[model samples]
Target chain A: MTEAVELWLVRHAEARDARPGESDAARALTERGVRGARRLRRALRRLGASFDRLDHSPLLRAVETADVLAPLASATRVNAGLAREPGPEFLSDLASEVARSHVARLALVGHEPWLGQLAFWLVSGWSVREPARQPAWLALEKGGALRLRGEIAPGRMRLEHALDSETVRALARR
Target chain B: MLHLAQRLDELRAHAAIARVGADSRGVHRARATAGRIAAWLDLGGWSVLADDVRWLRRGLARARDLDVIVESAELAPDARAWFARERAAEQARVVVLLDDERFAALLAALAELPEPRGKHVRRALERMQRRSLRAGDALERAVEPLDAAHRLRRRLRRLRHALEWLELPAPVLRAAQTELGELHDRAALLGALERSPFERATRAGRDARANELEGRLASFRLRWPALRGELRRD
Candidate 1:
């Protein structure tokens, strides 16, 4: 039997308005947002959550945040499919691409709808309530790192792991 | 009027001499000076048109040696009509000499008039030359910083492309780290989906793919920070 995949989901910090009447691609991370990302990086290190590969949204804000955290953990790559507005088809494609890679523990830094949906799929097998608007995190632990065949449920995930910047900072320091 | 004609000939001669070894900046300055000279000629009573003049090829043209060409007797009408046609075709005012015998004789007589040594004409020519030199220097200075930025962006892009071709020994571990980073971006998207009408009926599937990538990336980081740094730098 294969071990269950351990997934870590992280949301990007605050960013300035992208453009006056344009898409979110133009947005950039604010100073406070950068600090928050650094804090998260520290927390992941303290938690002993070692990642082998780092993937982030191609959006500038997400990319910048990932760049900050990547030096502390692993090599970072930008994946356009992980963007906030990806559809169901895109998520499925991402899952297949990831499955083929055979990574054990993965961390993704992206936006809202897609991440929330990904979390719901991982926990409930069916999406439950909407994911939190603020930075929310989910950790999944299943047996055998090769396939996600085990009894997957919300119980396997832990909330409040990365709810705020202060807590994340403390975790990093620890 | 005769003095003005001699002065114009001298200015044209000077312009022709300046065109040798001139770059784009130098050419522009020379053309501007020629324009000013043409403007002064218009103020005089000579029916001379400086329109459609090939300022760039001034020194190269054989016609520069000839003072005037006569093809007809109506000097003003023929010269004005040729000037209009040339200007329309070239999109610039060019100089043309009339084809009238009397007018040509008059111009020949004027060309013999003693040239003026006015300081204003000399000063204007010098200023145009100086302006061209400044423009050339400014262009040289602007390239360095712009090149640096362009090189950095290209290096980063190449590194990203190279990663696609790598087949690491521990694929699962690499996949996990990659997924973790991806999850960060996706989570933000999920947060926004709550406000939209395109709600999904089924949650995205729980997969082990992301975890494997993260684990791989972590292991690689521990083993090869130096390579990663090199990749980022280049």
Candidate 2:
């Protein structure tokens, strides 16, 4: 039996510009990015955000953001799967993982396009067959987070709200 | 095996200086001591204090950065004055951190830490060594190696500290750390020079710093192979 889950899908904060010859994955967060992530953490705490687990991409920026928000989760792990784009199998695996772990709430910190695409899929359904047919309404900015609730299966989840980085920071300041 | 008490004493002493409005050296020492304590805590399996240590370090970060920039980078006189003023403003934030309630709780936790069990020490050192090796491997494959090198530098520091705690010699690790440290400093200087105003006055100095950065990068690339080999042996 699967329990309803609250999934917080987060995009990693603004990354520093890559130096010459640097890999994209090796780029770390800028100082401003760190501050933004910390503010997001504080805002989440203020709103009483809690999660069963925090999973982040293996990439440096996501890992760093995850570290800042780790106090919200009971446990944290580096999920290499998050470093890749989501597909149908990805959602299936996620559903199974959530069921097995009994995770009622989870936070996923990852990169763009991937996170945007995942959020799109969860809110909309597989009815949009081609990737090109998907709407752009779910795009997330750096440091933004989307809160989804309900079943873990794709297309079944409800989009509670999507917050931009600025809003989150403003909320945090309040 | 960490002398938690001694480490805490060092943090307190340096933090006292920092809280009173730190000079550049005081900021450096306070930050370094806090980092050492954090690393020691990691090695000893004191996971509870991780957040506190991270919070403390984050609070000190700006102060440390300004200190390093002032000490290592060549700035136009006007730029130097501007940075000094900014640094002075930042000291107030650092002082506030020292008086924060979380800091007091961190101190109390450090005071109560027990010596790590002997069995855990070897396991912990092995874990740290593995992490360092992974970081070194990432550095080799990195397209932009500077950021990777910086990450490796941090892992290397933790490994060196763990070895020191165990009374083991780590001369190669120490040497590699120093080389990486110089490279990082040069890179920081180049970055600061790039952003500073008074560009016309600072151009020659910036170009010189750029060349220095390239030289250090090349030197580090040459040394990394042998360093990785040493890490593998350990």
Candidate 3:
């Protein structure tokens, strides 16, 4: 059976471009991205996001972002499968991880393209009939996060909303 | 599990969905608002009427296999109006079917399954690659009917989809597709030019346009192998 969970997919704050030869995995978040992460934290709290657990990719930027938002959730960990591009298998791993926590909601901090891909997959499979063109590839700007609510299964989740940093900040301020 | 599956089915059948699968996964329901009983399927044909909802079997998911490979039965209707209404007045009561520990196992079980999505993508990619090679041979030979640039463009697009599904790095393939798409557009325009009433009006000037189109086409072809090479990193 499918579980209805509020899954929040967070793209890491901005990171400096990998120095000429620096490995992308080693790069840390930029100061502004750090601010965005902070804003994300405030926003999640304000929105009363009850995340049972939070995890991020091993990459420095994603780890840092998770650290910034750590206050919103009870615990944080480096979830291996969340690190790179989220293939269909990654999703299964994630859903299983959430189920283990036994929480209806969880937060995932990670990189782009993958996050967007997951978001796209969750909203609907690549083939969708729509009023709004379900993202073929969602572009979640730096520090942006998308909320999915409804049944959690392979392709049963629904796109609740996409939040920008300022929106989070404003919501938090409220 | 059985109860939850039944509930999910009821939701999909009675309610309007937000985003469904990216490629082929089926429709999913957004939490609906209060007092908003789907009075009738007002959206359009193939869409259910809210007033008299008759849920289909497709809406029901697998209780045994937690990871559902849900397919949207159809992707033609525009459900924007209904969705917008749902958004405006949603007072949805949220629910979660599986507890945390169980949820975790179900998700992981899906991944560890004999033929998970990743494996499925691999198979799909292999099939697309075989088809691409056949298309490539025809493309290289510039076979008359099959040699059309549009056909090649279509082939590239399918290959791109497979690459995406497989989560493979596809910049080169993307660039190739874009170039082919542009070439297809130019070829189409050139063909249209030849058939237009204007072509007879200026028959003598047409050769210059044709030469330019052919030149671009040849250049695109010359670049195809290099682009194709980038995708073959086996």
Candidate 4:
């Protein structure tokens, strides 16, 4: 039986420009990205978001963000499967792994497109939810998560928060 | 046995650095050390795997197979491929065995051997130390600027908050507002410089510009706490 799990999906903060000939995996976070991560940590604290585990993409930028936020929550390992471009099969496998492990709440720090797709999968079903022009977040609660088990329609998952860069900047300024 | 001895010697070197106490040392020492090192290597996530015995045999022939192989379930396929290539290209394998006093003595003797080129060795060591010191200094300077920006940002935030809380004289408020805008711009510029490619460049021109910006940022950051404290007092 599948157990309920609260998954907090976070997109990595701003990062340094990718140097030519370097893999995306090697890109490091910028100073602003680091500060943005710290701001996210503080915001999560203020919001009282608690979790049992924290996982991040193996990519340096995502791992750094996860490291910054780990102290605020109880994250055990940084899983690489939660990287950018993780397909539906990978997500299914990950969800199954988490379910088997019985972890109640998990926070994942990853990249764009993938995150939006995962959110879409969780809420809408098969089709990918295109990432908003700006960084945004959706909270999938109740049956909203179950709908992601298969291909479903958009608008099925309730949009909890849609944060743009300006909103994030304002938050960071706070 | 010689190969195993050499591997054990390498393990001993690591143990020395790890400070594994003699009281806990035993036959398992080599295995434990190997296991620890393997774990570290696996965590680095760089390795290649082979499926068939043919490839594995070929890899062993070409690369000196280190006595320990650390494998993780989550290793990426590309990382695994890289590891495979590295193993296939390697010519020697490391063999680790438990501790031996005689082996330790041999390592000590090797260390005592006189340097063939004393002056060159000394100069190289000095250069390495100097480079390390310079890097540390650069890091120290970098933090100063970041801290300054952090403080100014915080102060501006508080002033805005205070403005929201009370009715202030228009001119005084206007002055504070104007100062806040300038501080914000300066903070943004400093942040941009911190992220710029020029910041990472070691060229004299870039270094000079970075140093100047760092100094200014540090000064601002250093004064912020006190400034904020004063504002609180008022």
Q: Point to the candidate with the largest TM-score.
A: 2
lDDT (Cα, tens digit) per residue for candidate 2, span A18-111: 7899777767889999888888888788778998988777677886788788878887655666777887776787889889988989999998
Query: Model 2 clash pairs?
Result: A21-B143, A21-B144, A22-B143, A22-B144, A23-B144
Tens-place lDDT digits, model 1, residues A27-46: 76788777777777677766
User: What's every prediction's RMSD, in angstroms?
Assistant: 32.8, 18.0, 24.0, 26.0
Instruction: For candidate 1, give the lDDT of residue B147.
Output: 34
Model 3 chain A worst lDDT run, 10 consecutive residues: A127-136
lDDT of each: 0.43, 0.78, 0.54, 0.45
Question: Can you give the TM-score per candidate against the true fold?
Answer: 0.36, 0.58, 0.40, 0.39
- When sorted by lDDT, best at the front, the candidate numbers are 2, 3, 4, 1
* Model 4 DockQ class: incorrect
Order candidates by TM-score, high to low: 2, 3, 4, 1
Using Cα atoms, each model's DockQ against the true complex is 0.00, 0.02, 0.01, 0.01
Position B18, candidate 3: lDDT = 24
Q: How many clashing pairs in candidate 2? A: 5
DockQ of 3: 0.01
Candidate 4, fnat value? Answer: 0.00
- Number of clashing residue pairs in every model? 88, 5, 30, 15
As a whole number from 0 to 100, the lDDT of residue A26 in candidate 1 is 53
Distance (Å) between predicted and true CA of B226, model 3? 78
